[model samples]
Structures are given as structure tokens and as C-alpha cells.
Target: MRYDTFLDEVLVKVKTYLAEDGTLASSRDSKSLAKTSDLKLPLEGSDLSSILVDIDDYLQKCVKTNHPNFMNPLWGGLNIAALAGEIIATLTNTSMYTFELAPLASLIERSILERMCEMVGFSNGGGTLTTGGSNGNMLGMLCARSRGEPLSQRRGIDGTKLAVYVSAESHYSVEMSANVLGIGLDNVIKVGCDDDGRMRPDKLVEEIERSIAEGQRPICVIATSGTTVRGAFDPLVELSEICHKNEIWLHVDAAWGGSCLFSIEHAKLMAGVELADSVCWDAHKLMGVPLICSAFLIKDLSLLRKVCSHGDAAHYLFHDETESDDLGRLSLQCGRRNDALKLFFAWRERGDSGWAKMVDGYMELAGHLESLVVEDPQLELMSSRQWTNVCFRFKAEEEEDASELNTEIRERLMQKGNYMISRSNIGEDVILRPVIANPGVTKESLEGLVAEVIAHGEDARRGIPSA
Candidate 1:
């Protein structure tokens, strides 16, 4: 086939995939799929026609994340404008390291970062687009370390003496950051949370004092804006006050819930966020941009520059004239992709008002799901509804094991491929977490999900195996 003909065929496939209301995914196991897939890699190259067959097989097996039933992850659905930007970025094939190579791309990235900083109330602040929230959190801790021990960048510090604090419900990335920073996991204190899963300020204060008493130097307090399982927001105002009193850096991991800032009604959830020293927000999460589009904003841009500063080893890349404009100077990476274009396209298409509407709609849908779980006699709401994550479980009679029964229901849902929601544990109880981040999710979608859970629960109780 001709190149243009091949391109046309791919476009047709994309259109058909978007319009179809098929199963969320194939029910085959990984071993089964591997056995059936075309895995041979011969010395001879395949023609364009053969490649089309491979593409069709791949598409047929892949999970339909844009489908209305796909509530398994924190992100779903598709943005047409952002998709265009992604394709354009790939077509251009330029590195984001230097302004000389990606002039327009560099400016577009800077503009997006500036607006995000402004929304977070960071005046004259700046940030870089990172791989994801994990890298962003690591950058935040690295900055804190540089601030605490200014010479630590050149001369390493005793990580055993340095300590970091986080909520018990904070993302696991905090612990990963600790490990990467050479701060032992034992020194990374986990502050207690209240009944609502929010970090208790009193517990944070207590932990800070205890660390100080133990000859440990507290460098940073990493507060969470939106927790992973429960979607709880820590008391930022109180946490900021505590950090300020102790002279420690405050980094808010708003990766999951940062889009709440776009909504006046929900922005109050992260009140006093401006007081934080640094923050990381993922547009790919609540904003519905593609994956790996996260920002790490710092109130003091110079601090970030200093933390990321490497000696003038690459004289080939750095020049005095374009030094200020180069994004590599502010990043830990040397060569990065143009992740900004997709986010910029999405943001421009949906202005702040559009984002507010999207956030508000998701919250409304989450509220609807919560009501369904509460009203049902066999269902239990595991946690308080905060953002768009509804954690619930199916309850059975005293004779049946509730946790096992719920697990069976989730396995059955996956086997049938009708819905794809996460199965998580809150405390000792197993809960089904169906987040409403997908724009395709509707009131009817959630109602069907609730009904399916009850039906599966009944089957499991009666000792009926999953179909």
C-alpha cells in the first residue's frame, strides 16, 4: 500500500475505535494472549499491508480507556485538540532541551508553566514539565535538601540525620523520593490522619518535635492535596503554618486533585495552597490531558535552578546568548520530549471556565455514585466522598466473608469485560474504587455499575463461579 493510503486506513481505524461501544478490554489472561499473539521477529521486514494487520490485532486487544465503563484508573477518555498536539509534536521530532532546536515549543511550555504557577498563587514562580508526579516529588525533596544543607549539592550530607514528613495516606512516591534522596525509610516519618483520612496537623507537629528530639533534622514536610485511595486533602493551611514555624520546606503533592483550583466551589478544598514552598500537579489526571504531563512549581525559581545546576560540562549545548531561554538548565533531564504541547492544546480548548465545568461535573457524578452506594442495603460506603473517587464494597450476610465476596465480584466484572473499576483496600476491608475522572462517565453509567456490583455480589454469595 502507498504511504498516504496507509495513513488513511489508520485514520479510519481511529474513528471506528472512538465511536464503538465495545467491551472495555479482552478477558484473556497475559499468558493466553502471549501464546495467541504474533510474536515472531524475522530478519525480513514486513510490508505496509502486513503492518495494518498487526495494528488491527493490537487495537482489538487493548483496553478501551475512552469507553464509559473504564473507571479503573485516575485518567480516561480522549481530548481531540490534545491528541492533535501529540501527533504534531511527534511529527516535528524536536528535542525540548534548547530554544535553538524547539523555539516555539519552549515558549509554549514556559507560558503553560507560568499560568499554572499563577493559579497556584506563585508570583514570579516557575517550573518544568517532568516525567510524572514521582519525579516532581523527588525534585521537591531535592530542593528541600539543598535549602537545608546548601553545600549538600556538592558535598553529600548524612541522610540518616535528615528527615522528611508525610501523611499516612500520602502517595507511595513520597517514600520513593526518600529512598532516591538517600534519606532512609526509617527517617521518613508518616504523620497520622484523622477519621476523614486527612493528615492531622497536631500529629505532624508531634512528629516534627519527636524527630528534633531524636537528633534528626527535619528538612521538609510533604503534604498531600489529594490522596490516592481515599482522595482526601490534607489541611494545607495548618500544615503550612507548622512548616513555617519549624523552618522546613513545604511541598504539596497535588498530582491527583490540583485541577480543583479551576473550580471556585472545589478550590476551597486545597485552601492556603499558596503558602507551600513547592508543588507538583498532574494535568493528565483531573484535567484529562495525556499521561506524563505533570508540573513541579516552586515559589522560588532560583532554588530550583540551583538544585538542578550542573557545572558547565556540556559547553556544546549551553551558550551565553541562549542560556536564559534553554529549558535544560532548569531540568534534571538533558533531552526531554515536547510534553507541553498536548497540555497547552487541552488548556486552550477548555479555558479555566471549561476546566471548572469539567471538575464540577465529575464531582456531581461522584456524589450520585455515593448516594447509590449509601441507599443500597447490600452496599457500604467505605470512606467519605471528597473528590471524584467513590470507595465502596458489597456487603453479604454474616455467613459469607465480605472481603472475599467483594474480591470475587471485582474478578467477575473483569472476566465479563463489561466494566473496569479498581479493587483496593481501606484498612482491613476490600473496597471497589470507581473514580469519575472520565468525561464519558454519566449518571446512567454509575447506576449500571452499582447494579452490576449487587448482581455479582449475589452470585458470589450463592457459590456461583464467575462467567
Candidate 2:
């Protein structure tokens, strides 16, 4: 087959699949297609026709993340232009390590990073793209550790006990960063959160004082902007003040909620983000770019350059300091894909206002879901959400366990191929967690989701078997 014909066929298949989705994927009884199917590598190479057929077969059982009914994960909504850019990058097969290799790509990445730093209100900001939010968080922690102890990198974080602070409701990546950076999990102190799931600045200050009294140095306080399940933005203004007063670094992990910068009305959610020493923003989340497009932005450019640049001066790849713009030296990743092209093309097409509207639209859908939960007698809102996630549950009889019933209802829904929303445990209650971030989804789709969950829950309470 011709290249154009092959590409057109694949696009048609994906477009058709996305348009008629009741849920992201048809339920397969908890078994994976990869294990069940005859997908094995052989010594012989398959023809183009056979390869295309295999592609179709693989997608048939795969979860359609781009589908409007997909309310499970943080990222949703696919941009055609950005997809085009991904395709173009793949065709070029270029890595974004050196300007000599990817001159245009390196420049585009710099432009995107500069714009993000400006949004973060950094005067002389600098940043590098990371694999994802986890990697970005690690980069922030590494930079903070370096700042706290200048010789720690060359030697080690020995003799001195260092501590890291974050909200109790922050993403687990904070703990992971500590483990990877040798700060140890015991020293990673989790501060308390307020009723709305934001980090309590008072508790943070108290924790820092306690750590200091114990002779443990509090190096950095990590704040969350849109937590994993609750979608809560930490009290950045208050936390920044505390960090500044303590003479410690403040890093805002805005992986999920950083898109607030795109919206003028909602940007106040991240007020005082400028005060943070460093910030991590994921364009792939609310901005709806492709996956793995996260930036670790630093307020001080010199710190980023000093902390990240540690190449042994590879002569062939990096000839001289003149080509300092080569991104590999400033990143943990070498031979990275051109992820910036996806964001750059999408930015050019959407512009700033367009991006803002996209964020507003997702938040509007989330608010609609919240209202639905509030009005329905069967639904109970687990947390007061300020962003895209709505955590709620279907009510059962007084004698029945609501948590168990909710779990049964979700499993039934998945088994019966009805709708797909994740379940999360808030304390003891298993709440239905729906992330309304898909731009193509509508109120009608969400209404159907509520109705189906209720219907399933009612049936399960009466001991009805799942379809």
C-alpha cells in the first residue's frame, strides 16, 4: 500500500472509533488483550498489509483515551494539530539532544519553556522538559537539595539530616523524589491539609519549626496545585510566605492544575505561584497536548544551569560551550523525543485565548458534574472540588454498605460495558471519581453516566447479577 493510503486508513479507523464511544473501551472481563491475543514476534517480517491489519486488531481492544466518555485519568481531549505534529516528528525521527542535530526543535522547545516561565512570572527563568510529572518533581527536589547544600552533589548528603515538606494530600511523587534523592522517606514530612484539600500554611510552619528543633534541616516545602484525586490547589500565597520566611526553597507541583495559567479568571487559583523557587507544569493535562509534555521551570536561571549541567564535555556531541543551548546537558534525559513540537504547533493554532477557553470548558464540565451530584438524592459529593475531578458516591440503604455497593456498581458498569469512571477511597468511603477533562464530552454524556451508575447500584443492592 502507498504511504498516504496507509495513513488515511489509520486516521479513519481512529476517528470512527472516537465518535461512537459509549465508554473509552469495551469491557473485557479484566483480562488484557496482549495476553490473550496471538501477538508474538517472529523471525519473519510481516508485509505492510498484515502490519496494518495487526494495528487494527491491537486498537480494537485498547482503551480509547481520546474518547469523550473517558473520565478516568488526568489527561484527555486530543488535538488534531498536535497529533499532526507528533506524526511529523516521528517522520523526521529527530532527537532533541543537540542544536546541531535538531536546531529548529531546540529553538521551539526554548520558546515554549520561555513562555511557560513568563506565565509563572519568573523574571530570568529557565527550564527543561522532563519525561512526565514524576520526573519534573524529581528535578525540582534535586535542584532544592543542591541549593540547600552546595557541596552535597560533589560529596553527599551525609552527616546532616535533611527534611522535605509537602501537604498530606499531595501526589505520592514527593515521597518518590525523596527516595530517589537519598533524603529518605522518614525525613519527608507531610504537612496537614485544610477542609478544601489545600496545604495548611500554619501546619507547614509548625512542621518546619519541629524539624529545626530536632536538628533536621528543612530544605524545601513542596506545594500541590491540583492534587491527584481531589483536584485541590494548595495555598500557594501562604505557603510561599512560609518558605520565604524560613529561607527554604518552595516548589509548586502544578502537574495537574498548572493550566490555570492559561485562564485569566481561574489563574487566581495559583496566586503567588511566582513566589515559588521552581514550578512544574504539565501541558499534557488541562492544555490537552499529547503525553509526556511536562516542564520543570526555575525562577533562577543560573541555578538550573548549574544544577542540571554535568556533562563530561563529550567532544563529538557537544563541541564547545558556544553550543550551550544543547538541551541534553541540562536534562537527565539523553536522546529525547521532540515533545515540544507538539506543544508549539498546538500553541500556534490555539493561541493564548484559545487555550484559556479550553481550560474554562473543562472546568465548566466539572462544575456541571458537581451540580448534578448535589441535586441528586442518591449521589453524595465526597469533597468540595475546585477543578476537574468530582468525587461522589451512590447512596444505598441504611443496612447496606455504601462503599461496597459503590465498588460493586463500578465493577458492574465496567463488566457490562456501560460507562467508565474510576473509584477512589477518601478515608473509608469508596467514592466514584470522575475527571471531566475531555473537551468533546457533553452534559448529556455525564447525565447518562450518573443514571447508569444509579441504576447499577440499585440493581446490585437487590442482589442482581452483573450483565
Candidate 3:
């Protein structure tokens, strides 16, 4: 078939799938999936028809993330303009290294980064698009390391005992970044958090002082704007003051909650983000952009360039004319795709108001879900809804094995294919975590998910207990 016909067929399939859904996926079992596709590589090329058939089979087994039933992950639904930009990017197959190779693409990327920096309240800041939010978090630590020990970039650390600090509820990427940056995991300190999951500013100051007295050089403090499981925003305003007073690098990992910047009602969620030296934001999470679009924005453009790259890494690739226009000069990566275009086109189509509207809707939906849990007799709320995530526990009064029972309920949900909400361990309790990230998700669907979960828990308790 022609490429156009093939593309048309894929769109049709997507539309049909979006229109009809019961469970989130047809199958979530490893054994069933293993039989769905041939494992071994074929020696000879297969016909287009056979390959298309194989593609259909693969898609059939995939989780319908665009479906309203999908609430297991922090991303859902689709943005038409972002999908268009993705197709264009694929067709061009261009990298965002230099203007000579991708002039329009590089320009587009620069514009997006500049806009994001400004959104963070920077007057003249700059940044780069990272592979993902995790990589962006890593970039934050790398920059802090470079600034603290400039020689560490070339000669490496000499066991000076550099340290990193973050809230107890921050994303694990901060610790992973510490490991990657040669700051041993042992030196990565976890600060205390209050009941709302926001990092306590006083605890952060105490930790930094404690590290200093111990002769450890505290280089960075990562304040999470939105945590992975709780959808909690750290106390950025208070944390900023502590970091500034102590001369520590403050990086805000706002991957899941950064979309609040677009909403007039929710912008307070990210208040004082401007005080942070750097930030990591993912458009794919709350903005409805496609997957893998994350920004590592820094307050100082020159510092990012100095810390992340040397002036002349590749003479052959970096030409004089492209020097000023090149994006690779400041990026931690090379041969990067034009992922910015996905968010760029999506933002342009909807503009600020449109995106803010979506954010407002999600926030409203989250509140609604929280109320549903509050009214349900069989359910107990684990934590308050801070953003779009509503976490609760399934408890039939006096059930001591509720955690184990809840796990069984989740597994059964996956097996039954009626809903797909995830579960998380908040402290000691295992609670069901449902994030309202899907633009297409409805109030009725969310209510159904709650009812179905309670039903599953009731059923699990009736059977043999899960080990």
C-alpha cells in the first residue's frame, strides 16, 4: 500500500479505538503478550501486508492510553496538533544540532525554550530539551556539580564528598542523578516532608547546615513541584529562600505540575519557581503533548553553556556560521531530535488560554474524584488531592490485610480489563492512585473506576488472601 493509504489506515484505527473502550487494555499478561508477536527476527524481508498485519496485532495488545479508561499513568488522550508535528518531525528525520542541518527546527526549539524560561519568570534565561524529565533532573545535578567543582568536568572528583539534597517525596531521578554525577548515593540526603507531601523548608535548612558541619559540600537541593505518586508540589517559595541564603543550587522538577504555569487559577501551584536556578518541566504530562517532551530550563544561559559543554567538542561538526544558532552547544546530548516542535505546534494551536482551560478541567475533575472517595463508605482517602491525583484505599471495615487485598484488586482490574488505575505506597499504606491527566476522561468514567475498585476489593476478600 502507498504511504498515504497506510497513514490513513492508522488514523482510522486510532479514531475507532478512541471511540470505543471498556478496560484499558485487551491483555496485560506476559504469557498472552508473548504469543501475540513472533519473537525471533526473520532472515528475509516480509511483505507489506504481513508487516501491517503484525503492526495491527502489536497495537491490539497495547494499552489504549488515549482512552478515557486509562488513568494508570500521568499522561492520557492525544493532541492533534502535537501529533501532526510528530509526523512532520519523523518525515524530516532532522536533528536539532545546528542551523546548517535543521534551520527551522533549531529556531523552533530556541523559541520554545525561551518561552518556557520566561514562564518560569526569568528575564533572560535559556535551556535545552532533554531526552526526558529524568535526564533533565540529571542535567540539573550536572550543572550544580560543574559549578561547585569546575575541575570535576575534566579531571573528575577527588573524593571531596559532594552532596545533594531533596525532599523525601521528590522523584527518584534526583538520587539517580546523584549516582550518575559521581556524588555517591550515600551522600544524597533526603529532607523531611509535611503531611501534604510538600518539602519542609526548615528541615531543608537544617539538613544543609548538618551537611556543612560534617565537611560535606552541599551542591544542590532539588525541590519537586509535583511528586510522582502524590501529585504534590513542594513549598517552592520557602525552599527558594533557604537555598538562596545557603548559596545552594535549587532545581525544581515540575515535570507533572508545570502545566499550572499556563492557568491563571492554578499558576500559584508553581509560585516562586523563578527563584530556582534551574527547572525540569514535561509538556507530555498535564499539557497533553506527546510522550518524551521535557525541558531543562536554567535561569542563566551562559552558565548552562559553560557547565554542560566545552566550546569546541567537535570541530568538523560545528561550523562558524552555525555557532550562534546551534543548539548542541549547551545540551548534555548530541544528535537530538526536534521534540520541541511537538509542544511548539500544540501550544500555538491552543495558545495559553486553551491549555489553561484543560488544566482547570483536570483540576476540577480531581476535586470531584476526591469528593467521590469522601462520600463512599467502602473507600478511605489516603491523601488530599493536591493537583490531579486522587489517592484512596479500599477498606472494608476492620480489614487488616487491606494492602494485600488492594494489590489483588489492582491485578484483577488488569485481568478484567474494565479500568486501569495504579496503586502506590504512601508511607506505609498502599493506596490506589488515579491521576486525572486524560483530557477525554469523564466524571462518569472516574466514578465507575471507584465503584469497580471497591467491588474488586470486596471480591478479593471473599477469596483466598493474596500472598
The best candidate in terms of TM-score: 1
- Ordered list by lDDT, greatest first: 1, 2, 3
Candidate 1 residues lying further than 4 Å off, grouped into runs, are none
lDDT (Cα, tens digit) per residue for candidate 1, span 65-173 = 9999989889999988889889899999988888999999999999999999999999989999999998999999999999999989898888999999999988989
- RMSD in order of candidates: 1.0, 1.7, 2.0
Q: Candidate 3: lDDT over CA atoms?
A: 0.85
**Considering summed lDDT, which 10 consecutive residues are worst modelled in model 2?**
22-31
lDDT of 2 at 312: 42
Which portions of model 3 show Cα errors greater than 4 Å? 1-5, 464-467
TM-score of 2: 0.96
Q: Per-residue lDDT for 304-335 in model 2, tens only? A: 77776665466767767646678877787767
Q: lDDT: which candidate is best?
A: 1
Looking at model 3, residue 376 earns an lDDT score of 88
Cand. 2 Cα-lDDT:
0.86
Model 2 / residue 237 / CA error / Å: 1.1
lDDT per residue, candidate 3, 49-123, as tens digits? 676677767677778888887888889889989998998898899878778888898888889998898899986
